[model samples]
Target: MTERSKEQEQGGQVRELLATRADEVSLPDGWADRVLRDGKRAVGRRRLAATTAAVAAVAAVGVLLSGLPGTGEQPPASRPEWATADSVPQALRKMPVGPDTDVPYGTRGEQGKGALRVMLGGRAIPIPKEYTGLRIWRAGDRGFVYLADGPGDVSVVVHVDADGTSTELERTAKGEHTTQLNVSEDGRFAAWTVHPYEGRSQVVKRADLTTGKVGSRSYDDIDSVHGFAGDDVLINWDARVQNIGSLDRDGTPWPSADRDGGVEDYSVASDTVLLSTSDGCMRAYSIAQPDNQRWKVCDMEDVHFSPDGQRFVALREGGYVVSDTSSGEVTGGLWSVPSVHPQDMAWEDDDTVLLELAEAKPARTKDGMIAPIAPQYGPSYLVRCHVEQERCELVDTGGPVKAFPSSSS
Candidate 1:
């Protein structure tokens, strides 16, 4: 069967799973209340600035599961609060314009003239000279996470504001490599994971961008860090278990879910942990209740939750699909592009996504198996898609583009 057919088969199986459970899974009594109470307690303990509003919003929505049969009535359609043209947050509004070029990620020699630029407000904004040669991760429009190599083989994670000021959030000594850095949806904290070459333990660290206070916890045999769920960090340890725990305290084991198929990747929201399993299924587990899981089977390989966690973008059959995390309903139609890497996509806002389109030609083996493209492939462009409107526009980033985390609250 063709790849599209396989995706359809998987989608059909998922529908069947949901259909079988429709009558059996009713909204648990006081679920909303419990979620709110628990969420508030967690937020208060962590003093998280970013997730406070989100927890409240989820409470107001009541039903967490989308498209479930038990919801009494469908709510009237209303524009998302961040959908307006003016809704682009202030941090992302004004960027310093610069010369445009097609080679954004090229080497110094390959960049003929002018500095590299990033696409902001559809204009190419020159990257500050101080940020040149550093790996830049946009942390919302509010600021950036710059991974720069320092003296003595140390690496620093610097937080740079949109206006060009910066502060060092954290630093790593030699032998430790920072594998992932994720800014919380609210932009108050930056959480990252570090792997040590000499040790088996993986360290998860969080820097309070507001206070400059940093905290961390270490786990044995950690596979990856899946960002933050409110104040706590989500970690996949030993390749088979996922845990959510505080970064400041070391104590009793936090709540965990064991996956037999192994976890491929995961995204955490305040109320739920969405896992993309090795078996090719997406599972949502309630943070308040770990044993409860809702599964959706599909051909989605990589899963990325929007800043608010209300929606997610997944790769299906060489294209992109945006869906409601709760209901698994596609909000936008399929977007077909030449090549999209999960790491190369970021949510511009709740309703928009920024994608990096690679120009490399896909390689087909003798048996017709497509080989993965390396990052070095030449020429890429930045494309911004409005998920709700189902339209995309090309933006000029002097070179390749890397999206930072959203800073909007």
Candidate 2:
């Protein structure tokens, strides 16, 4: 067993928190994004036509966000002035704080995550006392994080890189209104979960901030949809747990997983989907083979397939353990905390992770700042985490413990 100290990527915490699980995941573009959420606006920032809880896959927002044509055809949604694409600290932009109207939810605990802010272009974007959609920019010697009532509402994105170097990108939606926003790493794309109806849907859409070209996806298959496998494949039950249908990279429903059983959590690395069975078993499959070599099984809890699938990490009863996919070897058994069956897990970067300690709550809080006031299973969870090496950090972004916050913070 390896020392239970190293944190795995598949076990990281999200950037922000949402009110519902639907706000947590999103699909790819075109067919993939469409089938996932069923054409519904996302729960993050941007233009939303209606604010409805129609989380029925991409067929949610404004009707069906998916099933539409992925011709990149339509003119981009009309972005508002306040919704400019100027740069802001990518970190703060991903926080759970929003609108500045509602109060935070979930278990109240002492925050541990240091103020993780974003550096737009080059400068740090300051979070507004009220998050009313802002733009972030980094000029020569100055950095600005500005918010507007709407786009075009501001002429420039604060300041150009002083001497004409402007890495400012404004984000705006033309079709509906948005509640959440997400900017890609290269800064070439921006996806938003819009709002219009007073409803919630398991839907989401992404757009090239500059082109305004949009795409969508979803995960409303609660009973059917199992989890995400790798980059583009979404694992869903066929007959048995491992008898999974594999959605291609393009999100077009493809083949199926070779193995079968009560698939718990499935992770995709390379060409295989590492699946964990309910009976404490595990196996790997090749998207191409779907049913060839069904190998490996281990007794573990909270099994997570690594990003590359070369291996998997499971938080077993007493400690953590890592397994080699090829030979099903217990490379190492990490540390142990307590008996906690994590509800959700994400890889922060690769090594470290952000845990919610969710199971702990409905259980306990650090300083006990929060006492079950109206304890009724009404979001009374404390988001604290032990990031592998150090102490337990608090996830107090005011976002959904499950949601990665609004991709657009």
Q: Where does model 2 exceed 4 Å of error?
A: 1-212, 217-259, 262-264, 278-280, 305-308, 339-409
Best by TM-score: 1
Write candidate 2's Cα lDDT for 1-409 as tens digits.
Answer: 3322222211121111111222433322333322222222221222222222222322222222233321111212322222222221222222221121111112112232333233333233333223334433111123221222344322212222223233433334443344333233223444333333344424444433344345565534222333332323243433333222222124534344334456566555456656666667766666666666567767665655443455556665544555676766666543333432233343333333333232232434588666665222222122222222221222324332212211111
RMSD of each: 16.9, 22.2
Please, what are the lDDT tens digits per residue for candidate 1 over residues 1-409? Answer: 9766765565445434433433354534443333333222221112333233343434324442454322212221212232222423221122111222222222222232455444333334455544434565555555556565566666678776555556887778778766566776666777777778676657777777766788887666777665666666666676544445566554334344466577777777667677777787877777677667765655775666776779888777666777777777766543553433333566665676765555444676789777675433434444555564333434433334443332211
Q: Which ten residues in a row are the worst by lDDT in model 2?
A: 10-19
Candidate 1: global Cα-lDDT? 0.53
Top lDDT prediction, candidate number: 1
The C-alpha lDDT values of all candidates are 0.53, 0.35
The alpha-carbon lDDT assigned to residue 262 of candidate 1 equals 71
User: How big is the positional error of residue 81 in model 1, measured in Å on the Cα after superposition?
Assistant: 35
C-alpha root-mean-square deviation, candidate 1: 16.9
